[model samples]
Structures are given as C-alpha cells and as structure tokens.
Target: MILNGCAIVFDDEKYFSLSGDNVQCDQRYYITNPLTTQFHVKYKKKKEFSPKLLVLMTMSSKDVFDIYVHKGEQ
Candidate 1:
C-alpha cells in the first residue's frame, strides 16, 4: 500500500525550470500516520524519518506536460 506522505511535483510551464525559490515551485505532501498511543510509545527513543520527493515529469507524456522535482545545485 502506498504511504499517505507521498507527493509529486508537476513540471508545468511555470515550474519547468529550477529558478527563483526551489521550495516555492515544488509541491509538498505528507503521509498520514494512524493515531495510536502505542505508535508513539518510543517517539523519544526512535529515529525520525524525512519525507522523499519523487519526480514524475520524465515518466509522463507530452513535452509541455512534464513535471519535475528538481534538486538545486549542490
């Protein structure tokens, strides 16, 4: 099953290029964690997990309909 936190960024005309603020152009989403007291029992002792960004522009059809999740210059 897919997690709730999965997100994507469309490489639309406005967001095709990685310019200006990268965060502002990319779309962000988070997975929903089931609420349960048992789930957070080891919150303080457990490791934190960060969300991943997946790009779907290349996988999509059409030149003008591509969406990208670009990682700015290192």
Candidate 2:
C-alpha cells in the first residue's frame, strides 16, 4: 500500500492503494491531498471500526522508506 508518497508492504495482502486523489482501502473511505504530506483514514458510518493497527514509515537517507507495524493504540 502507498500513502502520502510512501509505499508499504504487508504480509496479509490486505492493503490500500492510491487512486488519483483518493485512497482505496477495505471498509474505509480515505481522501488524500497530494499537496500535503499527511493523510488519514475515515471509516464508513455503518461499518465503523476502530483502527487497531498503526503503520509507521520513515524515510532513510538513501531515499528508501522503511515500514513498521505496531499493534494497539500508539
């Protein structure tokens, strides 16, 4: 999955991808502004669920990004 100019990979294979100005993910509607470096996820009203997973990415000096997954609240 890619978010805010960052690419992420997960073992589960359930991931979101950027489609134009929108972020496509299961059970959520996330919109992204390309001009900004921050993005967030908004859940659907009927299918609302808490975000139990937090993904963090840091950009390295070599221009590569590293992804880290943390369970529970940050």
Candidate 3:
C-alpha cells in the first residue's frame, strides 16, 4: 500500500529480506492474538440458538462478544 509516494511494509515474521530499491523506510508494529470463547446451547425440534455479533473499526468503539458462566467448586 502506497500513499503519497511512500511504500508500506508488511512482514509476517517469516521472510529472508526485502526486495530491491531500499533507501530508508518507516517501521510499524501490529499485534495478532487468537482469543477463544465457549458457549452452550440446547436445541429441540430442529431449533438452534443464534447470537448477534457486531464488528467495529473505531478506536473509541466497544462491543461485547460473549458472556461466561462460571461454576462454583465443590
């Protein structure tokens, strides 16, 4: 991705080196975390449980993905 005569770099941590034509560049970092969620549903007579999900791209936006129910230890 180039914007206003500038090259954007993207390396997924498995590369030998950059291609030719390198003369100074800017560095950027991005994080990737795989989150897990568990949900339970009981269906009868061909019925299913579906939940609504939303995705936001703004920095000041927030959304809830799932809710957890914990059990007490005996």
Ranking by TM-score: 2, 1, 3
Candidate 1's residue-wise lDDT over 1-74, tens digit each? Answer: 36455544334222233332236543443446536335434243422332334455433232345455654342
In model 3, which residue pairs have backbone atoms overlapping below 3 Å?
Answer: none
The better-scoring model by lDDT among 1 and 2 is 2
TM-score computed on alpha carbons, candidate 3: 0.17
Best by lDDT: 2
Span of 10 residues, lowest total lDDT, candidate 1: 12-21
lDDT of 3 by residue, 9-72 (tens): 4322221222322224523223353243222222123213322233222221233233333332
Each candidate: RMSD to true structure? 18.0, 17.7, 23.5
Badly placed stretches (over 4 Å) of model 1 are 1-48, 59-64, 68-74
Q: What is the C-alpha lDDT of each candidate?
A: 0.40, 0.44, 0.29
Question: Which residue runs does candidate 3 get wrong by more than 4 Å?
Answer: 1-61
Ten-residue region with minimum lDDT total, candidate 3: 38-47
